[model samples]
Structure formats: C-alpha cells, structure tokens
Target: MKIIRVGEPGLERPVVVDDAGTSFDLTTLTADIDGAFLAADGIATIRRALAEGRLPTVDVSGLRQGAPVVRPHAVWCIGMNYAAHAAESGAEPPTVPVLFFKTPNTVVGPYDDVLIPRGAEKTDWEVELAVVIGRRARYLDSPADAARHIAGYTISNDVSERAFQLESSGGQWSKGKCAETFNPLGPALVPADELDAGNLRLWSRVNGEPRQDSSTADLIFSVDYLVWHLSQVAVLEPGDIINTGTPQGVALSKRFPYLRPGDVVELGIDGIGSQRQRLRPA
Candidate 1:
C-alpha cells in the first residue's frame, strides 16, 4: 500500500493511496505517520480498514504534500555506496559502508522550495533511495533479517554544498549536508513488500536538464547489508531514515554546473514517485 501525508507543512494528515490511485483519509485512524504508528503495525491496520471498507475517500487536489512521515529520530546516510558515483568523485568502493548523518531538521516536503544556504557557491544534488525503518534493530544476526525491520521506501534528494563538504569542513560531510531543506523526501511511503529496492532506476534533473541517471543495481553496499551493518554499531529505530547513497551524475563530479537560485530540480526513483524543488537564496 502507498501511504502519504497531505496538508500545509507541520499540519499534514495521514492518507493512504488505493490501488486505483485514489487517496483515502486516514486521520480517523491515526493522527500522523511517525515511529509510534509504524511500531504498532499501522500499515496492517490500514489494510484491515480498507478490506472492511471503512475509509472515506478524500479530494486532495490543492493540498500540499508533506514528507510522508513526521520528524524521525535521525536521518542516516551511506556515502560512496554506489560504485559509479564513487568513481565519478575520484574515490574507490569502500570495504565498509561510509556512514554520515543529516540532522533530522534538514528534511522537508518533497515539493517544497530548497534554499541555497547563504555564502554557498557549490550546492549540488543527489537522487537516492531512502529506507524507512519500521522496527528497532540492534546487532542483527544477518542481512536477511533486515527485511522484517523495514517499513517501506521513498525518494530523497540528498542536497549538498560542495565547498562546505569538501573544502572548508576539514573532511566531515555533515557540515554540508545538514542545512535546512537539504533533504526533500516523499510523495508517499511504499511498503517494503511492494518494492524491489535493489533494482530501481533513480535520476535527477536541473531545470529540465538531465544530470544524474543510474540504477540501485550498482550499489556496492546493498540495503540489507547497510541496515545490518549499521545495527552493529547504532540502534536502528522505527522512523529512522537511511539514505542509501546515489548513483553517478551529480554536479559534484564537475559534469554539470552546480545549482543556482531559481533553478528547478526534479528527481525520483521508479515506483516510489518523484519530487520537484525550486532553488532560492537562504
């Protein structure tokens, strides 16, 4: 099932999209889509409600689509997980996953305006597959155990500022990744069973021009392994988001000019849907 949140920012209401592409209001059943709801098997409850024909379809024509879930505990990211993306950035595939963090406040509605931080001159874009955790996971025994802990999948634009990330930060990427609106996520949160996360096509475009175009098939560290590996060091909790890296073709490789004010960026992953953000000065 595809789940969504719609309304003005911070006032979003949970919603579910039916097989026919119709959206049904889920506010009567849940206040918001967050860790608490997922931990309680909210998806299963929604399914039961649908089967009983107890939900009311709602018109969402003019509503703003908020990030599918509310503020998560943390937003974890895997860097250089994609072989081609690594090559483009002059790095080799890592023997272990390269993890990083984007402050939870960096997340915003998928279609919201993205601000180019003041004094930022090298802002860039990365289209990645984001994994949302559905349960607590710590020191998992195997990668195979990851499936049960996953809530679903969604799209994320891992917006970055190159100068802060590479030149002035003394090597920590988080300096460039945690700016407000740096992570634009969702249109919907699709359940794990509904997506083959290992092989979807993801891409990005700046003002209608293609930039990054690649597939998850090239990931050096797959979703399951990243999850299991992360659990060995940090507890992965419900509503924690993992951005599983990006494929080649970002402005960071010097293949395209970095984003500037007024630039419109569009990006998405197959099945998970897409998002558009207009750049503005912070």
Candidate 2:
C-alpha cells in the first residue's frame, strides 16, 4: 500500500492507496502522516483498517499533493554512495558513508516549482530514493536490525547549487543543497513491507530527455548499511528522512548544463512512483 498526503501546503490530509489502487480516507485513523503517526505503527493500523473496511473511500481527483510525510525532524543525505557518481565528481568512493543535511524546510510537494536560487551558477538536479524512519534508531547492532526502523520509501529531488557546494566553500555540500524548495519529495510513500528498497531502477529526465539512468544496484552503500552506520553516529528519530544519494548524470559532472528557469525535471523509481517539478526564478 502507498501512503499519500493531499491538499494545499501545510494542511494535507492523510490518505492511503491500497493494493487494488483504491484511495481511502485515513482521518478516522490519524490526522496527518507525520513522525508521531509513524512512530505509533500507523502503517499496520491502516492496513488492518482497510482489510476491515473501516476506512472510507476518498476522491483525490484534481487535488494538490503534498510531500507524503510532513515536517520531518531532519532530512539526511548521503554523498558518493554510487561509485560512478563519485568518479564523475572527481572524488574517490569513501570507505564509510558520507553524510550531510538539508534544511527541513526545503521539503516541498513533488509537483511544486523548484526555485533557482539567486545568482546561482550551477543549480542542479539529483534523483534519489528517500527512506523515512518509523522507529527511533540508536546504535543499531547491525544492518539486519534496520528494517524495523524504516517506515517506507519515496522519491526526492536533491536540488543543488554547485557553486555553494564546491567553489565558494571548501567542499561543504549543505551550502549548495539547502535553498528554499530545494528538495521536492514524494508522490507516494510505499510501506517497507509493500516495496523492496533495494535493487530498484531509478532515473531522471530533463525536458523529456534522459539524464540519469541507473539502479539502486549501482549503490556502493546499501540502505541497511547506511541506516546501521548512521545510527552509530546519530540518533535517528521517527519521521526523519534519508536521501540515499544519486547516481551519475548530475550537472556537477560538467557533462550537462545546470538547471535554469522553465526547465522541467521528471524523476521516477520503478514501483514506488515518480514526480515532476518546474524550475522557476527565486
């Protein structure tokens, strides 16, 4: 089943799309799809409610879609997780996970406009598989224990400004990463039990032309490993987000031009869903 949040910004109502592709109201079960709800095993509750016909059918036609989960406590990002992405950026693959953060406020709806930061010379797009935390994770004993902590998965466009990422700073990535509307997330959040996060095909397109075409199989660091490794260094609270890094084909590689106003970017994963965004001036 896929969890969806719909309505105007900051006022989305929780919804669920069942295996049969039916949309159901989750208001009787929960007010919103957020950290508090996920921490309480809302996915399981929703599953049971649907099976029991406790949820009412809802129409999502012609409505605005919000990020599947709202106001996450944190948005964590992994860098150089794909070997080819590392090589393309002139960096060697790290032995350990490389981590960073984007301002939580950067998160926006999948169909929202991504603002091109002022004076930005290298605004870029990165399509990544995003993991949402369900349970609190701290110093997990092993990668095998990570499954229970993950709520589900979705799509995230890790929009960036290359100058702030590389030239202006001494390689501090967040400066380039956290602009208003920098992260466009979701269309749906597929429950972990419903979708396999590993080995899925993910790709990006600009104006209908393919840009990034790769699979999670190309990741040098797997999802389980990233969760466990991160738990050791930081307390991962429920509703947190982990952007599992992007594959090659980012403009930072100097092979393609950076994003400009009016550019249309479409990114998708095989099963979970896809998202589209229009670039506009900040």
Candidate 3:
C-alpha cells in the first residue's frame, strides 16, 4: 500500500492510496502516521483490512500530500556511504559507517519550499533514500533480521550547506545539517513489504539538469547492516528515520554550481515516488 500523510503541515491526517488509486483516509483509525502506530501493530491491522476489502475509498485528486511520518524521534543520516559519492568529495570509503543527525524540527512536507539559510552561499542538494523504522530493535544478528523492522521507504532531499559542514567549527557536521526545513520528505511512504529494497534507482536534478544519479546497489552499507549496527549502540525506537546517505553529483563535488533563490530541485526513486521543491532565499 502507498501510505502518506495529507493536508497542511502539523495538521496532516493519515491516508492510504487504495487499489483503484483513490485516497482512503486513515484518519478514522489514526490521527497522524508516527511511531505509535507502528509499535501498536496498526500496520498489521491495515494489511488485514486491505486483504479483506473492508476499507473505504475516496477521490485522490483534491487532497494534498504531507510527509509520511510526523514527529519522528530523530532523523539519522549516514555519510559517504556511496563509493562514487565518496570519490567525488575527495574522500576514500570509510572503514566504518559515518553517522550524523538532523534535528526533528528540520522535517517538512515533500513539496514544501526549501530555504537557503541566511549567510549560506554554498547551499547544495543530495538525493537520498530514507528508511522508516517499524518497531523497537536492539542487538539484531544479521541484515535479514534488520530488514523485518523497516516500516517503509520514502524519498528525501538531504540538503546541505558546504562551508558550514566542512569549514565551520573545524569539524562539526550537525551545524551544517540541522538547519530548519533542510530535509523535505515524502511524496508518499511506501511500505517496505511492497517494493524491492535492493535494486531501486535514484536520480536528482537542479533546474531541469541532471546531477546525482546512482542506485542503491552502490551503498557501502546496506540498509539492513546500518540498522543492525545502530541498534547495538542505542535502542532503535519506532518512528526514528534513517537517511541512508546520498550518491555523488552534489555541488560540493563539482567545481562549480551552487543553489540560489528560485532554483528548483527534484528527485525520485522507483516504487517510492518523487518530489520537487523550489529554492528560496532565507
């Protein structure tokens, strides 16, 4: 099922796109799509109803879409996970997974405007694959076991500011990552069970020109392994999001090209959905 949140930011309602492509509001069952529903077995109940044909359907055309998950506990990220992206940034593949976090306040709807933070002259774009955790996890044994804990997938633009990330405070990456409105997630949240996690393709464009284009096949740490590894360090709570990192082709990797007001950014992944945003001066 294609799960999504719809309506205005902070006031969104849970919804699912039914078999006929009509939107069936899940508001009657839940208020917002978040960690609680996953932990409470709401997903399983939805699946059973869908199988039994007891859910109602409505017109999909008029409703606006919101980020699939609301109020995620944290937005976790992995850096330089793609070999080519690593090479492009003048770095070698890391011996261990590189992790970072984006404050939950940075979350915004998929099609919302992305701000160019004040004094940010080097704003950049990164098209990334975001994984949503479905249940509490700790000390998982292997990738296969880790996979079962994923609730779904969504498209995310891991927008970055190069100078703040690489030059400021010597080496603190969060200063560059925690900007408000930095992460635009969800045209829809696709349940992990419905799609092929290993083979999905991803690509990004800035103002109608192609930039980053790569596949999940290039990830240095597969989704399952990262989850397994993270669970060992801290309890993996439901509603926490993991941004698996971006592929090469960002402005930082290029000798020229940085975002300015009015620039448009777009990206998509197969089976997940696509999103486009207009860059505006802050």
Candidate 4:
C-alpha cells in the first residue's frame, strides 16, 4: 500500500493507494498517517480492506498531496553518503555516519516552489531518497532488522545554497541548508513492503537538462545501516524522516553552474514517484 497525505497544508488527510491505482480515504479511520498507524498493523489492515472491496477510491488529481507524513519530529540528513558527492564536496569519507538536522518547519510538499532567497547566488539542488521511520529503533547492529523499522520511502530535493553552506560564518553548513522551503519532500510515502528502498534509480534535472542521476545502489551507507547507526545515538520515533544523501551530479560538482532565477527542478525515484518544483525569486 502506498500511504499519502492530501488536502491543504494543516487540513491534510491520510490516504492509501491500492494496486489498482485507486486512492482510499484513511482520514475517517485514522486522524493522521504517523508512527501510530504504521505501528498498529496498518499495512495489513489496509490491504485487507482492499481485498474485501470495502475501500473507497478518490481521484489523485485536483487535491494537493501533502508530504506523506506531517510535521516529522526531526528531519535528519546524511551528507556525502554517496562517494562521488563526497568527492565533489571536497570531503573525505567519514569513518562513521555524518549527520545534521533540517528544522521540521523546512518541510514542504513535493512540487512546491523552492523560493530562492534574496541575495542568494549559490542555490543548488540534490535528489535524495528519504526514509520514514515506522517504529522506535535504537542501537540495533544488524542491517537485516533495519527494513522492519521503516514505514515507507519518498522522494526529496535537498535544495541548498553553496555560499551560505561553505563561505558564510566561516563554515557552518546549516546557513546554506536551512532556508525556508529548502526541502520539498514527497510525492508519496510508499510502504517498505510495497517497494525496494534500495536499488532504485534516482535522478534530478534543472530546467530541461539532467544534472544529478544515480542509483540507490551507490549509497555509501545503506538505509538499514544508517537507521541502525542513528538508533545507537537517539530514539528513532515513528514519523521521523532521514534524507539518505545525494549522488554526485549536483551543481556544486560542476565548476560554474548554479541555479538562477526561473529555473525549474524536476526530481524523482522509481516506485516512490516524482516532483517538479519551480525556482522563484524571493
């Protein structure tokens, strides 16, 4: 089952899409699609409803699809999890996972306009696979158990500004990463059972040209290990999201290419879905 949120901003509702491509309302059944739903045998119940022909179908068009999950407690990110990206960023592969935070408010639905901040000259784009936590995970060493803790997967654009990221305040990356509307998150949150979080092809294009393109197989740390490693340091709550990092083909990788005003960014991953966002002047 592919779980999603639809409606306007705060009024979003929980929904599930069946194999027939029909969307059923899960709002009346669940207030929101969060850790609780994923925790209480949600996938099985939805599948059962579909089998019984009791599920309702709604057109996916018209209504705005919000991020598959709402206000995730934390938005954790891994920088340079892709070897090529690490090389482009002029950073060596870390001995362990390198983590950072994107404020929860930075979260926005897929296809939303990515506002290029005023005076920004280094705005960039990154196509990444985001992981949604389904259960409380902590200190698990085995990668095999990682899949069990994942609720679903989604597409993400880890938009950034190189100047604020590398040159400002000496070298704090958050300055470049935390701009409003920086992270455009999901087209949908596909259940882990329904899709392969690893091994899918991912790509991002600017205007009409390809820029970033790679497969999840290129990830330095697989989703399972990243989750397990993170759990060792903190509680992995339901509804939390982790951006597994981007591949090498970013603007930062190019010698002199960067997004200017009026650039459109299209990004996607197979199975999860795709999103196209316009870059607007702030």
Clashes within 3 Å, all models in order: 0, 0, 0, 0
Residue 4, candidate 1: alpha-carbon lDDT:
92
**What TM-score do all the candidates reach, one by one?**
0.99, 0.99, 0.96, 0.95
Native-referenced Cα lDDT, model 1: 0.93
Q: Counting only residues 3 or more apart in sequence or on different chains, how many pairs clash (N, Cα, C under 3 Å) in candidate 1? A: 0
| Model 3 clashing residue pairs (backbone) | none
Between candidates 1 and 3, which one is better according to TM-score?
1
Give the clashing residue pairs of candidate 2, or none: none
Please, what are the lDDT tens digits per residue for candidate 3 over residues 236-270? 88999999989988998875499999999999998
RMSD versus native structure for model 4 = 1.6
Q: Which model, 2 or 4, shows the larger lDDT? A: 2
The positional error of residue 212 in candidate 2, measured at the CA in angstroms, is 0.7
249, model 2: CA deviation in Å? Answer: 1.0
**Alpha-carbon RMSD, each predicted model:** 0.7, 0.8, 1.3, 1.6
Per-residue lDDT over 134-181 for candidate 4, one digit per residue giving the tens place of the 0 to 100 score: 888888878888888898899879889888888874756777888888
Candidate 1 local lDDT, residue 249: 91
Give per-residue CA lDDT, model 2, range 96-150, as digits (tens). Answer: 9999999999999999999998889899999999999999999999999999999
Residue 24's lDDT in candidate 4: 89
Superposition TM-score, candidate 4 onto the true structure: 0.95
